[model samples]
Target: MTQTSATPLPPPEERRRLREAASLTQAQVAAQVGASRETVRAWENGRTTPRGHRKEAYAQLLSSLAAQTAAQEAVGEAEVTWRQQSTRPLTPAQAFDALYAFCAPALVRQTYLLTGRRELARESVERAFQFAWQRWPEVARDRDPAGWVRATAYDFALSPWHRFRPRYRHPEPPPADASDRALLDVLLKLPPPQRRALLLYDGVGLDLPETAAESEASTPATARRLLHARAAVADRLPALSDPTELHRRLAELASAERLRAAKPPTVRDSSERRARFWTRAAIAFTVTLIGTTALTLRTAPTRYEPPVPPGQTVLGVPPKVAPGPLSEREVELRRKLREETASGPVRLVPETR
Candidate 1:
């Protein structure tokens, strides 16, 4: 007797949860895997089973989305826990305190890696948190608040606004060892996307697909970037030849960044600062309003001259004139036309007797 084995399938709930966690719709997953929406829904609902290539594609896509979802969920849980710690009304100050204490260091480190400027990194992280404080209610409800802040901080660090800001004379200290410096040089030389992919994948401990998502690129594109980054690094740094050594080096770099991030400048109480900011803003607004009002009054037309007393016209006003007769030249032209019409050649009519 011949026996056939059946492939085990993931649970429907698991499939649905992974899709939702990745913030993807059934249609999106179907498009990615070249399957129909109904087919994907059927698979997720356990109404049907994927076969051969479809099964493999489903498994791969599901696994990748699952990893990304897991990373985001981990951050989400941290945010939720932080929020749950206090039962009292959450104020901006209180919210900032919680987020800063929990997420600031990590964000700073991430920015530092991105920009390679310590002061810029610090400023970027602080500004991002400040924005978070301003929008605490919305941010607090975010699925991954820490990730949101990190992304904000990264964008701020790379913003062109920094060009106008005062430059720091002193640079951040370099890596202690030659190998570290070489590694940094190699990383810095890579294109932004590739570098970000490398850092997120190797340094931040995110999986390949998660790194792709974070970099805002497709998995295949991210994989290509990672390959290019690794090839460049391998060419420059012989020590990174071994996979174990490469991981160790990346871990060391991550550790160093964390250490640097830990000692950020003390954040002042935002309550007083916020109060002062609003007070200044209000005063400026009031002054501007007064100035605008005064200017309008000065520039406004004099009050309506009491409508010119009924019949009596104003001194400078001109009287209305009715249309006059045609000019002399026009009259002469009209007379000539009448004469020409009366003097026109005449034909005699012959009458039969």
Candidate 2:
């Protein structure tokens, strides 16, 4: 007689474990199984199971995922131990190095999750780090510098200018398992605000308040968004029904995403670009001043004496003229006066003689 193996776990438990191991969301498995995500959830919750051929196919998929996850986990455990040992405290410069090493990859992964574009995600993270490096003192003093950078990266990824540029797509690394891809697909379907809330709370491990602050939403609003997101996720991946497991899996997926690519180099210091900007601004101001002055001088009126009228003189001198002859009345009156004077003077002259 042939030896037989023990029966496998119940479908619900098996489904949950396999989904976690594969890092797939229920939505992903549902797509593969040609069933609704709710149906998959029901199967995992022991509310129902696939009948006949579907059940057999689902089991096979779960078994395959289990085998793959086991092998990957063995390697992951070793790597994680090494990473944990390597992370330690250091001096300021070394601390920045440590921070970059610790945070940049994760930031990039977070950006990628938000934008779904690899190159844009990388650029966003690099730009955020560049800003961080430029303002190291302030960032270092903050309680959550990494969160600050992550927030910056998120904003950068969502910039509208991205729509105008030709998309230069960098192929993403294949998902560690179907579950990861599925979850990411679902996340990508979410509105940016909801996606950000979920990532901050679940993926980045922020509390509700912090997540709300990051998403620029009120606490109640953020909570509502998270509630909706969680329900959606649970519908797809029944394994994530457990809040603890949901957080754990989200954190694991975030870590795996970080490992997908190397931490992009800390962006080159922007000091040179800043210096150039100031230099250009100064030159522009000086040029503007000089140009305005020259324009004023060129356009200004010149001062000089105005021309005088033809007969006018600065000294008030009159023009020379000839005198007219005496009138007839004046001549007649002078003759009469002469006669009278002659008559009267006759006696006086005789006496005088």
Candidate 3:
């Protein structure tokens, strides 16, 4: 009966947060709840909720873990809890801000390496965060929100559209250090996919499978990219042959420059404003289209009317004759008459005078 009792679960996002805070994997939680990993994933993604006894088990597990996290935080002990705020219930805004603060700076730096431009790097990360804010519920419940944002940032930073923009047509200035410059040039030289794979694998310390997943490439393809990228770098800069050294150099290269990300509040505000603008624009367009359609239907001709043919002149109609030179006979006659009929003409001339 107790197992059958009604036990309301936390919101999907919070449930995920609680699980993540406890450092338990989705498979682990699913095992406890007697469900598959995908089922738990669906539950956390808000696609589906557990039923009957499973619901209570899932709820109780999250509640207990949350309590344990709170207790751990209460005492003065530095441990791997939520990276920013304590696991106590967090407002969405608070959680979002905490996540941004923890992840944005480092992500910006990583993005800067991915694209050799400070401005593009900063913009990419901010844009990615903006997207995350728009889909906060989905992103918050995601197993790795930071990775989600990172993937988004990579997509934006590596987009071919940027190349067409006048502002981003040319590459930004390279780093001052010779090694950093060479490394960046080499990175820029790599294909976008390869570049992304290398950054995820070597620079961000993601394992091969994780890197492949993030890159959206097959495992074999990702491995080839990583190998080719590493070979390219090793060829150009023998000093960075080691993967650990490459990571260190990448970090140093990114940190040596000043790449600042916008604050979370600003990013959120911008995203909200942009979303509202697009929504209003869409509404306006729909109204305009509907009105135009209505007007067209009301005023449009109901029946077909053939167009009148262009005017054509009648073939039988005569054109007026224009005077031309007189005939030779008539000219001779006129000259003879003028000479023979001089008496009447002379009288007339005297009367006129």
Candidate 4:
């Protein structure tokens, strides 16, 4: 008979011991060691064994667990030794090292300020330490891991998708009074470039160069923007004062700026064009309307009366009378003259004959 040998099976007791040593939950260990939770469970139960890279990963995981346990045990021993050696309390530095290993007030403040989310900032710091612990050799050899950690925090804080990216979302105004409303009303009238320049410089108290940098504008451009912004605000200055009103004003300014940017430019043939196209168009329209109205009024017809009804007249007036019929005496005298004139050449005897 040929001799037969069996492959070694995973020991349930050893797997359980490794799990306990690693200070990790099954899920955590499974994730890190690239094994399924079921596979880890099987191994712990001595039902199956990992092979190839999986076996190596399993061994490394168990080793890491053992190291973590040892470190904790050592820390516990040291604490106990310290307690026995001194009845007095530990100094702040000693206490911090004992509790957190490392801590700094400036770092805390910066973490909070940058993240704007206290919890997230704290979590980030915690993860930084955890990462350092996992990769101590690398982090220890690096000359500026602290700088790297800070940069990570800042990157998280300044991400475009982060809520705190703008750092001025719905900025709280000083007060909610008439002055604020007035200030907003004035700011509303300004164009966007002017508004940005004015607010960044005057409202935010940035110097000219700083404002230009922030706005991504040239100094001369910024100055012009400020001038226009000032002119607009000044028109309503008597009423504006409150800071919250600034947002409303800025909204209006932004809208107007968008519209202006969207509007098409009027074409000019010459580079040195002095005339404003819109202004000229407006003047032309007004003149044309006036001329049309005048022409219409001049050409309108006049009303006619029937020539004052013949002889009838007004004011120092006159009137006409009908003509009389032929007189009866003239008819009888003509018959008598005819009888006497019957004689040839009747000597111009009067009709008395």
Candidate 5:
């Protein structure tokens, strides 16, 4: 039997150059990944990279499509096959940038709707980006990074601890006045399980199966949760007005989100910018001191002292009380004893007087 030698494949960089030279647009490339055009452009331009699950997916699509096209050509099809390879293999940075771009708009809008402040939305999304960056390696591998980030942001925003201890505070109303109200009303009408399913499905645009995974329920249960939530909103919509108005309002909210998307803040990494070292140290020291004091109090022993006696007379002696008299029958018995001694059997025997 004769063994066949497999030819080595070209690197992703060479493939990207070849694709670009072919005059195909980034959007056309991204259509293969089911991603937006911006994502493709960013990947090709070195602004980002495909990663993890996306990398495997991209590779599969590229290879499979290439094979199919080659087979078709052998059969006499004149259509040219487009190369669908990623510009680079998966990396954490590329994955972070991709997920950040994907989630930024939706997250920012949600922040605005909740707080009515674009600045707050910017801050929230920026922090969310930082968090996503920290977990980029894992998230990039996830099938739906966008939905994952949304759920995380929602959890962050709704944290009870945040109500009292916030990194920074901003008081603002939600955008799209009537729309906000209607959305809130609809949300309020939903039970917790149903609300979670509905938001993950409709608001974040996840399918029932994905929503089911997020909500920790079976597929049928998740479907039921969404149905119940929709029913609840539907029952209330008649009293509120046309349901289409709610959707229009939501679109208005989404549009408003675009206006509020600000460039994320950047911190310069320079040695000359050395600042806040002493202030940070002082804060740490203060917190440490407080914690130490609390620990000491918790571990300290308890001591109690006996009460002192009255000052004047004695240390341990108690006060005495007067004695009371016996009954009259004791006096009668004494008198009878004296008479018996005097009588002495009625005889004065040995009475010398």
Candidate 6:
């Protein structure tokens, strides 16, 4: 960087980017540049200025790092893994396998960090990959398939609805380390938006703009959420106030856990199976709808039928009088009729005639 006319070093953020892109830790840069790690950090953060030989050495290291980063970009570190399947014509399965192999393990770990549940993490990554495979055509055409899958996994892992599921209703066990448990507790306490912003920026190494785009917010709003998340974490764990330190801690926390993703072939097969199941379900639903529609069309009345009229109240009619107590003459006649014999008086006279 200082070779021709002593050009000035790049900006602080650029310096940090170069170092990280080269995968060199601050201590490694410090060792190479003959300075303390703190000094290297300060230089990268723009907190302090380097001088003389150290400054020139830092510049040289940065130059090397930039070259290294550029070389990797040209050659493509991850592209090498899929060079055969992605570059050459290959079966969709092979391409999917390649992608699954490349992104699954890290995705699982990242999900684990997001949810603090190992089983849930694995499930989320698998579900994300399944969704990708189910829509492989779209995913293949995507600019960054890994990014697409990562967003899916994050959405699943951090979903509020998971709390309603029987499996995810209760809290998962805390990390074995007290500090880790504390940090995780603090992290989960943040609103999902803030948590997601923090993870995408600090944990995932995305630039602020990319993070904002992933978070689907304006740049300023994303910055505010990120700052708020960092402030919350810093309040709980004062040591993690530094973004770099938070990144390191997040990486450490994820790496310390034994997260294992399903094999690529298994994921592919499962995705295929899931796709088939849903397709069959959709077909069944469509057939049922068609049958029901046909039955209704055949059985339904051709014209509108007026409803039967309800019963009406009857009009006034004769009010029959109930019988009352008998008069004395009527009573005497009923007594004589009862006293007389059955066929005596009138029947005998008709027989003689």
Top model number, lDDT = 3
Local distance difference test values of all predictions, in order = 0.75, 0.76, 0.89, 0.55, 0.60, 0.88
For model 6 the local lDDT of residue 54 reads 86
List all candidate RMSDs to the true structure: 24.8, 21.9, 17.4, 27.5, 18.6, 16.9
Off by over 4 Å in 1: 1-96, 169-171, 217-221, 241-245, 257-279, 282-286, 303-353
| Position 115, candidate 5: lDDT | 41
Residue-wise C-alpha lDDT for candidate 3, range 1-353, written one tens digit per residue:
66535656889999888888889999999999899999999999999988878888888888798889889777535554444446578888988999999999999999988888889989999999999999999999999999999999999998888888899987677777887788899999999888999999889999999999998889999999999999999999998999989999988888898878898999999999989999999999999999999999999999999999999978987899998899999999888778766565565443533
User: 1-353 in candidate 6: lDDT tens per residue?
Assistant: 43632747899999999988878899999999899999999998999988888888888778888888888887786677668655678798988988988999888888887888899999999999989988999999999899999999998888778878898877777889988888889988888899889988999899999998877899999999999999999999999999999999999888888889988888888988988998999999999999999999999999999999999988897788999998999999888776564554774333533
Across residues 204-293, which tens digit of lDDT does each residue of candidate 2 receive?
778999998877889999999988888888888888877789878766666665434344342544534665787899999999999999
Name the TM-score of candidate 6: 0.62
Output the TM-score of candidate 1: 0.52
In order of appearance, the predictions have TM-scores of: 0.52, 0.51, 0.63, 0.22, 0.45, 0.62
Please list the residue runs of candidate 6 whose C-alpha ends up more than 4 Å from where it truly belongs after superposition. 1-86, 302-353
Clashes of each: 0, 6, 0, 7, 1, 0
lDDT of 1 by residue, 1-353 (tens): 01112334569889998888777999999998889999999998889988877777787787787779888889999988887875668666666677778888766766666666777887888777767766778889988788777767766877756767668444567777776677777877788778778777777777987777667799999999988888898999876866667777877765575444332224534434775899899999999999999999999989777665558546977888998899999999988777766465443233459
lDDT of 5 by residue, 116-228 (tens): 44665566666656566655667677787776766666555544455464543645444446655666656645666776676566655678888888666899999988777
For model 3, the stretches where C-alpha displacement exceeds 4 angstroms are 1-85, 302-353
Worst 10 residues of 3 by lDDT: 76-85
From the highest lDDT down, the ranking of the candidates is 3, 6, 2, 1, 5, 4
Q: Tell me how far the alpha carbon of residue 95 in candidate 4 is from the true structure, in angstroms, after superposition.
A: 20
Tens-digit lDDT string for candidate 4 (221-259)? 998887767666656663334434643453333232111
- For model 2, what is the C-alpha lDDT against the true structure? 0.76
Q: Would you give me the overall lDDT of model 1?
A: 0.75
**Model 2: which ten-residue window has the lowest total lDDT?**
1-10
